[model samples]
Target: MSTETDPVRLSFRDVCARRLEWHGLARPSAGSRPADVARAMAGVHAQVISGAELGVGLRIAGATRTDVRAALWGDHSLIKTFGPRGTVHLLPSDDLPLWVAALSAVPPPREGFPEDVRMTPEQTEKVLAAIAEALQDGELTIDELNDEVIHRAGSWAGDLVMPAFQGKWARWRQAVHLAGMRGVLCFGPNRGRKITYTHPGRWSPGFEPAETLPALAHVVKSYLRAYGPATPQRFAHWLNAPARWAADLFASLAGDLQQVEVEGIAAWVVAGDTAVPAPVTPSVRLLPYFDTYAYRVGNQPPGLLYPGRARDRVLRGNFQALIVDGVVAGLWHQRRSGGRVDLTVEPLVRLDAAQRDELGVQAERVGEILEAKPRLTIGTVTVGGHA
Candidate 1:
């Protein structure tokens, strides 16, 4: 457990600790082709150990909203693709087809949508083609893009048609993926707008495309290396992929991986893997809502946060989290008005003075990032355990 006690054979917690140093800052490109970032973190669940850095860290590191977005998708194809929950996710470009192929294996559970409403693979292909044609070399704002999509799909042909009769274009996640493919959907350029759509092919020239299997293998390897001391089931959950396919990914990575036990459960870690060291004592981090680290756990051990509660909050359009000693020790929320950011902290356990000091400092820093300061208020600390 101590850094002095053998640097090799990192525990799950240990692996999570230094992830930011290795995976984010020390990267060759400071984590460029941000999609590669997902692949790198995939070694651990395709979730970065750091999750969404809070406002404090952003100010301290001089990272803006644009920087974070760029850092997350530098070269990856899809941001919100398949994962354990059929939710949107950021994925590496090379692994996109494989992930799409794997997740598309079984039709997603049809819930409220009628069976007749399902779009077959052929139909989806047609949709993609039409979309590609309309957006291939062009850029459109969200409204313009939606209109183009409706027009190109011929969904707006007649007024008598039922709203349900129109074929759906891309959902939030898919639209982002299409943008990734086109290259115009980049950081800024759109500048703090919602779902700004652009052509990727026009944005970054001379982009290199990696092969599918190799990319898949790389993703599998990265997850085990970064997040390992984890299992295939955990990975399948993180990727929103099939258990069998996760197992296959593990099998393909046999020679490059090693297995270990944490608290009596079996898991795998990459051989020769070393963890980045955290401060001698644990540190606290203020994380943004929906940070990848906050959501990567898929019904597994070393439980990080309140998944059910987090999911509920996200569904309700609200969430803020805190990381203590490299784990999601609490949830938080912020309110911004009149150029001031108000922070509320609800911890699962009691915070010592040191933790409070660290948390307060981080909170102030985050406010600075948004150019909103002191009118910064730390709400009453609520004490409770994470369910």
Candidate 2:
């Protein structure tokens, strides 16, 4: 390992390939649990639940959507909650304490609502307390929880304020994300078609947030392990934190991190983790929307991971990416009707016979994960990007 003043030098290709290996893409982990995959990837984005399942399933041999769900709602090994950037994600249940502590430490973003639409700090605190109390017994649908919150907190909690889908959301709704990060709220199993919310204690009894400083250190180290040789700007982007705050956080932990030069660009990694493996050979993968690997790589230099058309087609549009040896090589989409799934792949670079065959095999794997029959077409995908 190199010291802060003695930076280690690494190539872009080596760094990219190393990240793939760390993410379990270069070689999937056999017989791995869903939580194992979730923990390794920091957290699996669950804004699109099916996409989250695909992201976790693809990293574990013989895993499927059912397996991920079982870990989430059945075995209590995984918990769905608000994570990085205040986005919904599936994280390891055991790690909730660390995540809650680290995430709660981040300063909240400036209020974006008008004075009349915004909740006062006191109201926000009262709403958070009500959320924790309401979920203490069991799960509650959003509507049911809303009534309970308004009843317990005050009518002020029910005031329509912040803008949402097509209408304004209740003033209390603004505190939901903060409630989740504070270990007071999380997603419960769905009731037929409607989603539900519950307290973290429902699954992990007596759950409590960890100490802030140690939790933050663990989060930073875990990030570097998965996507390291990265700058504070990249870290800030990944965490959705202010650039100045991330830079100061990095400086505070300088003794535990090692300075490095990735293709002449300055970066940092865990102090003892400086080894760079040889560049990976050609490999093809179909990554679903919001896959951690796809989104995290966006912070890297465009020339390295999103060269040429990929920057516009994949990163700019936030489309499902076709990864070839650690770089975004194309776009892909899947449409399912009953037991059949039709996959459309649009490759920016012409694939040879071997690569085409591998793509076919990858398509079959996706079908197995979804329990559908797959029909793959190596042509342009006409569908637009999804949120």
CA lDDT of every candidate: 0.50, 0.85
lDDT of 1 by residue, 1-387 (tens): 112223244455555555544444221242244454455555222223133323212422554444445544543243433243444355554454444444434233424333444444554454455555666665566566656656765553222222233654333223333333322233223435554444434434544344556656655665565556678888776665667877877777666776655555666666656445664343676666455342356323434433444434332343456666655566776667887777787665567999888778677667755557634344543433222
| Candidate 1, lDDT over the whole model | 0.50
Instruction: Give the worst 10-residue stretch by lDDT in candidate 2.
Output: 292-301
Deviation (Å) of 134 in candidate 1: 1.0
Candidate 2, residues 1-387, lDDT tens digits: the string is 235566778887788788788777887789689998888778888888999999888888888899999999899899999988888989999999999999999878877778888788888889889999999999999999999999999998888877899998888898888898888999998999999999999899889999999999888887788778787788888887888998888888968988888877788898978876665455888999888343454257666687789888877777888988788899999999999999999999888888898899899999999989999998988888885
TM-score of structure candidate 1: 0.68
Per-model TM-score on C-alpha atoms:
0.68, 0.96
Worst 10 residues of 1 by lDDT: 43-52
- Per-residue lDDT value at 86 in model 2: 85
Kindly report which residue pairs in candidate 2 clash with one another.
none
